[model samples]
Target: MATQNARKQDPQEALIDDLRDVLADTEAMIDDVTAQGGEKALALRGKIADNLRAVRSRLYDAEQKVAGKAKEAARATDTYVHDHPWQSVGVAAGVGFLLGLLVSRR
Candidate 1:
């Protein structure tokens, strides 16, 4: 139960950390933009914006990849059950019977 709860919270904690880093980077970028002048500042600003956009795109792609992997896992599980229905059932029954026996012994 504790492990499951931790796993559920882990992504949110990681996202918060990532946001903190991005915020720090943005603050630094702002300082850099202020330090430069005229055309240089503008160019730097543009580059910073482009980099932020690229980071956003990469984050989205990574999320899509994770989702795809989860879907693939679900499909693979489904395929396995379909291909080995009797084997899967037998294994499950065997495990349940062994657990029951252990409990009875206890």
Candidate 2:
């Protein structure tokens, strides 16, 4: 049951978990470097800071791209539904019925 639940975990949740782990490790490394207190530690901290900035920038770009795509998809779907309301309704009802049957079986 635990394995099944793990397998069913959301992709976004998994990504968040991975990000949290990375953040925790980074914090630990920074703490260790601070305790050491040397020029090399300073350099390493600078490098880590740069890498984090780069990662943050990439994540922002990815978020923008995903949001743009989602908006485009929503616009297209809205237009389609408006153009063919009956067809959209039929499709939705069919999908709902199928889902109900699948849930009942499960």
Candidate 3:
């Protein structure tokens, strides 16, 4: 179970993680370059900072929306399972059996 959990990577989560890494690196680069004295550089830096802020805001909003939807889906599934316990069990069993068959064939 632990190995299986580790093996499957959610692509969206991976993309988010990569984006965070890039944002961090870009901010660090901006900070490192801030020491140079130039009007154009300063203006460019300010513009970049503003754009990063907007990107961060949008990313945050997207994360919140995804989280809310996930929570709603979880709640609905829970309600369905509670309402139809036998049906849920039967569906899960069917899925598991199908997976077992495919895995064995491979």
Candidate 4:
């Protein structure tokens, strides 16, 4: 069950997870660079900081977009079910039947 849930995660969740890994790596690199005292290192650190900020901004925007799309999809589904309750139930039953058949085959 846990593995199934993990596999069913939304694309946005996957993206956020990957970005978090990248951010952690960048922070570790920054820490390592701090030990080296030199003008070049300082410049490199500044560049890295700028890149980190840009990536953070992009991640935030992507999160918002994904949230918006999810909300929109939910709203559409709600409206459809409300407008055609019987049809929705029929569709749900058909899907369940198909799933049961597939599972029984295994």
- Give the best candidate by lDDT: 4
Q: Per-model C-alpha lDDT, please?
A: 0.76, 0.77, 0.79, 0.88
lDDT for each residue of candidate 2 in 1-106, tens digit (9 for 90 to 100)? 6346446765544454455556668878988997899999999988887877776666666556666877999999999999999999999999999999999998
lDDT of 3 by residue, 24-98 (tens): 987986887687758877887998899889878877876777688789999999999999999999999999999
Best of the candidates, TM-score: 4
Model 2 worst lDDT window (10 residues) = 11-20
On the 0 to 100 scale, the lDDT of residue 43 in model 1 is 82
Q: Which lDDT tens digits does candidate 1 get at residues 55-104?
A: 77766776677678779999998999999999989999999999999999
TM-scores for every predicted model: 0.49, 0.74, 0.76, 0.82
Tell me the spans in candidate 4 whose CA falls farther than 4 Å from its real position: 1-14
Model 2 CA lDDT for position 105: 100
**Prediction 2 TM-score vs. true:** 0.74
How are the candidates ranked when ordered by lDDT, highest leading?
A: 4, 3, 2, 1
Q: Choose 3 or 4, whichever is better by lDDT.
A: 4
Model 3 alpha-carbon drift over 4 Å, by segment: 1-22
Give the CA lDDT, 0 to 100, for residue 98 in model 1: 99
C-alpha positional error of residue 66 in candidate 2 after TM-score superposition, expressed in Å? 1.0
For model 3, which pairs clash? none
Off by over 4 Å in 1: 1-45, 93-106
Model 2 CA deviation exceeding 4 Å by range? 1-24
